[model samples]
Target: MGPLPLNYRRPEYVSEEDSRQEENSADFYDKVDASLQSGPSGTSTGIPDALTFDKIINGGTCPPCTVRDFMNYLIYIEHAAENLQFHLWYRDYVKRFDAAPASEIALSPEWTQTMEEDTIAKIQKDAADKAKKVSPIAREIFRGTDFEKAPEIRVESRDPFSTPPRSSSGDSVSLSGSQATTYVSQEGDAFFAAGVKQPFTIQPFRSEINRVIATYIVDDSPRQLNLSAREQKAVVRALSYTTHPSALRTLSQNIENTLRRQAHPNFIRWTICNGNPARVTFARGLGVGTILVAMTGSIILTLSKAGRGWRALFAILWVIGIATLITAAKGMCVVLHGLHHRHVRPWELFIDDNATGIEQLCEGKRSFDSFDSCNSYEDEPWVVRYQRRFYVRKVFDRQVWIQEPVLRQIQDTIFLQSMLLALLGGGTLTAIFLAVPAGNFF
Candidate 1:
């Protein structure tokens, strides 16, 4: 009578309402557990775990996919990201230091000889530990990206210029080259024979020395790559020695200016430069997607000309078109670049794909590396041998296969000589588009 008297026990019965309540409770707990497991930035890892090289080399998380936690591709991506950010670091922090009237670029804290030795020892030890952590099985797949030293620019004989010869009397002959023939330089600038034909004067000799320095660097490395300190100093010293003592001041100025240009970041990258033949052909096929995007934007811009929304839409669509064209043609991946990984090849190229390799990979595979040991999350790494065989058996005709080669093409230096005309053409179209009414913009 009064919600059951203390002496009278209520009888138990199953109800649909009870089941629904239990299910909701379970869902809430599941969400809380997921949040606790998630890394900073609300991602599975601060960087999306899917973005890792493991996913690229293996495949997705479905039954057919194989996953690797510590892949060589991941190492490459980390360094590539660091290198790109380093240029941005120079442009912001380092450049600012250079410009400040009172503030010079600060050096690392001074260390005694013993301290320096200790620091170097620590770095070596850390590298050794990382090498050991992956086990010998991962050694082939996980080539360490932590470089002891970045590559330096080496001076080669007669670089960026024809050989300088001496007259019969032993007096130095003037530096010479054909002005009519086109010359493509590191920065992708092309000089026609006509433009440079009448340029044998001592005037702008500083520029000549700077251009000469450009030719010394190896082309394998991208332009965004920085030179080591010793190399930089050596470059300045060499240029100084070549110039007459009275002109040493001018030579120093030349070196300083040249450093900026030499270190400028790449705006575009070509897949053909770093990718194989299959990858390049695949990249060209993506042009259709860009066309579709442009057409969609055109339709929206035409229909929405009634208000300021159309103006904003036009700009957005135009920018998208520009980016799409560059990517479809040049094969640049901002994501891969930021991660510092070049999607050039598969992990199999670097690893052993035998039964032993599979056993080693599966030995301690786990979903999250730093999470609880008892956790049941499963993240079995792909057996390289099995995965490769699967792709080959299917002839790799899967829908996802198309993206594989395209990623490899990104991060190329767009040949400015070839793209110069295209850029001008785009600029003119953009100007005309911006000026015209939305419906008539095309």
Candidate 2:
């Protein structure tokens, strides 16, 4: 593994008198040196276990750390595994056939030559791309080639997960140094993609993981990039995917120093609002229309009668317009959020907020999962943090968007009452204005 940057912990505060005494004493200096060499206290200072899937998924024990962070955590592991897989594939298949006669190989000599050239070129390209830290696989995936398929996996005879290679005398040596690990060492469930099961456990070597952290976090991160608690949580999650049993021992000190020392990202970074474009467009248009209608109603009151009925009606319209405007600006068709038919942004750790808000607006009622009504998400696990996201989609019971829900979903009895309230409020204000003639006030 590469040597990491030295990590210095933020020391506990001491009185100036004590500080001066410590500086004057050789004992204090010896204690400081000892602590530095031994590392800081706590389990965090040790190498975290790398074989548990749940450990990787749980992005550390911090609030706002989420599954979205977990996916970001997967990038390094996936790339490291991908590159290693490709190299192993070449070694086991093509290189093994290199010394054989052309006739002995299954493919034609010309075909074999093409395979060798292509694999070599790809390997070179992969190495060059790694200099930037982020994986080049994404760039390659869009080109739509064989790489779009899950990278092929093959364990070497030397790999801990693989069966030992047979000796000339036909004995298999399962025990090799400290790597007396079998495929079962990766005793975890497999990942599922497109309803198909994949068997190879996704893991990154400790060294590769360290390099990634150093490249992105310590040495090459943009100066303005501030690492927050959420980001720190992500790094912790990433460590859990390392193939090395004691990965944290090798990487945690560097991880902590890098995240702490790095400057924070700016308030407005590259952010994508995940929503159905069609729904967002519709909501915006409706919001504009509602605002216009509110303005028109206000204008009409200026010209028309100040009777109680007219005043009452316009006040209701005004309220509808305001609610509609707010709903649209949020990229939320109140209907879509209620129906659980919406795209979730990576930052959207809580979907229940929408449900609770909508039910309040639509029915003036509360939800069973409302924080005030139920136990709140105070310090639950990351999985529990993720649960809110999934629970937002629990729509079987909601009455707001019954059947083919749409932007018109809010047009229920409560909707009508809101319109009436807007009209009443608008008309009453108009009557008050009419009572105090504008010419006299001017």
Models 1 onward score TM values of 0.23, 0.28
> What would the per-residue lDDT of candidate 2 be over residues 1-442, giving only the tens digit for each residue?
2211123111222333443454456685454344333233311321112211123233431211222322222222111121122222223334444555544432222223343345334434443443334356675754576545444333121111121232322111111112212222211111110111322233323333333333222211211112332222233333333323232221233222222111001000101111334555665676667657756765565455554345445555555555555545433455554443444432233445544666534432211111111122234343454445443343222222122121122223223333455556556664664454223211
How do the residues 1-442 of candidate 1 rate in per-residue lDDT, one tens digit apiece? 0111112211122232442343346474453344334243222211223322223223543211122322222222222221222222233433443454432112212223453345334434443453344445545555575533333323222111122222322121112222212122321221121112222223223344334333322122122123332223233333333322222232222222221111111111121233333343444444345435655654566545454344334444344444434543444332333343443243333234433766546543422222112222123233343355443333222122223222222122232322343355445554554565656443
Model 1 poorest ten-residue lDDT run? 260-269
Q: After superposition, how far is residue 428 of candidate 1 from its true place, in Å?
A: 4.0
For each of the candidates, the C-alpha root-mean-square deviation to the true structure, in angstroms, is: 28.9, 23.6
Residue 33 of model 2 has an lDDT of 41
Report, for all candidates in order, the number of backbone clashes: 11, 23
lDDT of each: 0.31, 0.32
